[model samples]
Target: MSSENKIEPGDVVKLSGAPNLHMTVDHISGNDVTCIWFDGSLHTISHKFSLSALVLVKKKGH
Candidate 1:
């Protein structure tokens, strides 16, 4: 994972950079981020990013 990549909560990540396909990261890890789908499914993505690439959208509301 490059230091340039910053992960945060509420970030709408582009899953494969495809139009409309995305996920929101609820938490961030050292080299991976934890994401949650509208269906409540959880996933962990690496900072490197790929077809499952993700980006920081916004911070989670307390």
Candidate 2:
């Protein structure tokens, strides 16, 4: 595999712009990525965002 970052299911990700809390990558279709995260009220929220709109989160000190 190439030494490049790639997003996959189960990976943690967030919005490229206006990032807040991180979301889990539930799935991907074409150019859309399905993300799931909990809201302030601890409610599960599922949303679809374009791949270009998401950034693969790299934890510090990997």
Candidate 3:
């Protein structure tokens, strides 16, 4: 993915191939990422995912 497409905290993203898997970026580390869902759920995913594995929804305006 391009630098502009990199995920940041508060950005809303959906797992590209997963059904109904949406999350809000909560934190990002070197290769590990964390997110919170609309239902107050938290998850961690690998940053090495291909671009097709994630879709950026809403960006954090701040």
Best by TM-score: 2
**lDDT tens per residue, model 3, 1-62:** 67678787788888877657777777776655666664435345434343346688777884
Q: Rate the local accuracy (lDDT) of all candidates.
A: 0.53, 0.83, 0.67
Candidate 2 Cα errors over 4 Å, as ranges: 1-4, 59-62
lDDT of each residue in 1-62, candidate 2, tens digit only: 13346778888888988578799888889899999999999999999999989888853235
Reference-based TM-score of each model: 0.46, 0.83, 0.60
Q: Which stretches of candidate 1 lie over 4 Å from their true place?
A: 1-5, 39-52, 55-62
C-alpha RMSD values across all candidates: 6.2, 3.2, 4.7
- 1-62: candidate 1 lDDT, tens digit per residue: 34335556666666545556566766655656666555335454433343235544443452
| Least well predicted 10-residue stretch by lDDT in candidate 3 | 42-51
Worst 10 residues of 1 by lDDT: 43-52
Clashes of each: 5, 0, 0
Instruction: Tell how far residue 48 is off in model 2, in angstroms.
Output: 0.3
TM-score-best of 2 and 3: 2
What are the runs in model 3 whose C-alpha is more than 4 Å off? 40-53
Displacement of residue 16 (Cα, Å) in model 3 is: 1.7
